[model samples]
Target: MKETKKKVVNIQEYKEKRKQKEVDRNELIALIKQIATLK
Candidate 1:
């Protein structure tokens, strides 16, 4: 039972990390687009 709880916590952490990474990637893309347009 303890192991299952730990696994659930790990999964939550992994999901949060993935979400943050996606947001960062999107922001980077937007910045790139703006720079491209400026040039």
Candidate 2:
């Protein structure tokens, strides 16, 4: 049971990290688009 709990925690942490990375990726893309439009 303890092992299962640890696995769940690890999965949740991984999911959070993945979501944060996606958000960062999207923000970078938006910034790039804005700069391109200004030119």
Candidate 3:
């Protein structure tokens, strides 16, 4: 039972990390679009 709880916590952490990465990637894309428009 303890192992299951630990696994759930780990999954939540992994999901949060992935969410942060997606946010970073979106910002990077937005910057690229702005630069492209300038060119």
Candidate 4:
């Protein structure tokens, strides 16, 4: 039972990390677009 709970927690953490990474990637893309427009 304890192992199962740990697995669930790990999965949730992984999902959160993935989501944050996606957001960071999107923000980076937007910044690049702004820089391009300025040029």
Top-TM-score structure, candidate number: 4
Question: Residue 11's C-alpha lDDT in candidate 2?
Answer: 100
Q: Where does the lowest 10-residue lDDT sum fall in candidate 2?
A: 1-10
Model 4 per-residue lDDT tens digits across residues 1-39: 999999999999999999999999999999999999999
Q: Model 2 off-target regions past 4 Å?
A: none
Residue-level lDDT for 16 in candidate 3 = 100
Candidate 3: list runs displaced more than 4 Å. none
All candidates: TM-score? 0.92, 0.91, 0.84, 0.97
Instruction: Encode model 3's per-residue lDDT on 1-39: one tens digit a residue.
Output: 999999999999999999999999999999999999999
Inter-residue clash pairs, candidate 2 = none
**lDDT measured at residue 5 in model 2 versus the true structure, 0 to 100:** 100
lDDT of 4: 1.00
- TM-score attained by model 3: 0.84
**Superposed Cα deviation of residue 25, candidate 1 (Å):** 0.5
How big is the positional error of residue 28 in model 3, measured in Å on the Cα after superposition?
0.5
What residue pairs are clashing in model 3? none
Candidate 1 residue lDDT tens string, 1-39: 999999999999999999999999999999999999999
